[model samples]
Target: MQLSKKSRYGLRALIDLASAPENQYVSLSNIAERGEIPAQFLEQVFASFRRAGLVKALKGPQGGYQLARNPKYITAAEVLEILEGSYRIADEDVSPESRCYAVSETIQDMLIGPVNQAMETILGKLTLADLQRSYQERATQSEDMYYI
Candidate 1:
């Protein structure tokens, strides 16, 4: 399954926030500009994050957003779940009385189950810190590659 725009933008914004100096609050406008995300959309995303306790916000002149906990403590799966609601690739919609019930069950058991499990394993293990490190590495590599 593909990630929703909210999830993609939220994760990118989180990475941007996580890269900031520890405990430093970052303005949503700054993150939106840096990530090329729409400010209004990112604000909505951040609102959900704040409600979910993944981020903290401050009001007033010097106010902004910051991670509620260390980046290493927040998993990609947690972020995705907060933004996307559920992580299952497919829902069990076929009823036992349906003609295609057996086929649906087989697909769920043999394909969807394994794929979901794999996704959970990967995302559950990946934290914002991991993403930040990977992003930094890519940025550094790109900077090292200059056109002739």
Candidate 2:
């Protein structure tokens, strides 16, 4: 299934925050501009993240948002779950008397189920710190290439 805008923007914003100087409060407008997300939408996403304990918002002039925990301690799956609800592929109960029961069951068991598990496992294992590191490496390579 495709990721919704909420999850996509939220993840982008989180990565931006993770890449920022530690303990620095990043403004929502700044995050929206840098992450290319709309300010209003990012605000909504941050609200969910705040409720999920993924971020903390501060008030006043020198105020903004910061990660509730270290980037290395936060996984992509956790962020996705907060933004998109449960990431489970599907587990709807169907009638045993349905004509397509066997075919559907086979597809879920053999294909969808295994793929979902793999995706979940990968997402679960990937933390924001991992993404920040990758982004930094790419940025460094791009800089070096341009300089050369």
Candidate 3:
């Protein structure tokens, strides 16, 4: 299943936040600039996260945002769910009267269901801290590369 831009940007922003010093409040604009995400779009994404208690926002000159909890406690599945609603590969709704209903049921039972389950297993185990580490590693590797 293809992830929506909102989900992708949200995850990227979260990883950016996770990379910051602990207990630091980072401005959304800074995150948007760092991640190359649109400031307006990131604002909307952060609103959803704020409503879901995934993030906290502060107001005023030093105002910004921060994760509500430790990155290790927040899973990718949870973030995707908040940003994209559902991460299921396919809708289970199939008219039983349709000619392909049986085929569809087989596909759902044998393929879609298992795939969604596996996705859930992987995403559920992948926390924001894990993403942060991965991003840092990649950044480090790229920086270490020498130009010809």
| Model 2 C-alpha lDDT per residue in residues 1-148, reported as the tens digit of each score | 7888888888889989998898999999999998889999888999899998889989999999999999999998888888877887885466779988888888888988998899899999999999989988998898888442
Query: Each model's TM-score?
Result: 0.94, 0.93, 0.93
Q: On residues 13-99, what C-alpha lDDT tens digit does candidate 3 reach at each position?
A: 999999988888999989999999999999999999999999999998988999999999999999999998889796578799998
Better of 2 and 3 by lDDT: 3
- At residue 35, candidate 2 shows an lDDT of 81
Return the clash pairs for model 1, or none: none
**What do the candidate models score in CA lDDT, each in turn?**
0.94, 0.89, 0.93
Residue 65 local lDDT, model 3: 94
Score residue 64 of candidate 1 by CA lDDT. Answer: 97
lDDT of 1 by residue, 11-129 (tens): 99999999999878889999999999999999899999999999999888878999999999999999999998997787589989999999999999999999999999999999999
Top-TM-score candidate index: 1
Candidate 3 whole-model C-alpha lDDT, 0 to 1: 0.93
Candidate 2: C-alpha lDDT: 0.89
Model 1, position 101: C-alpha lDDT score: 99
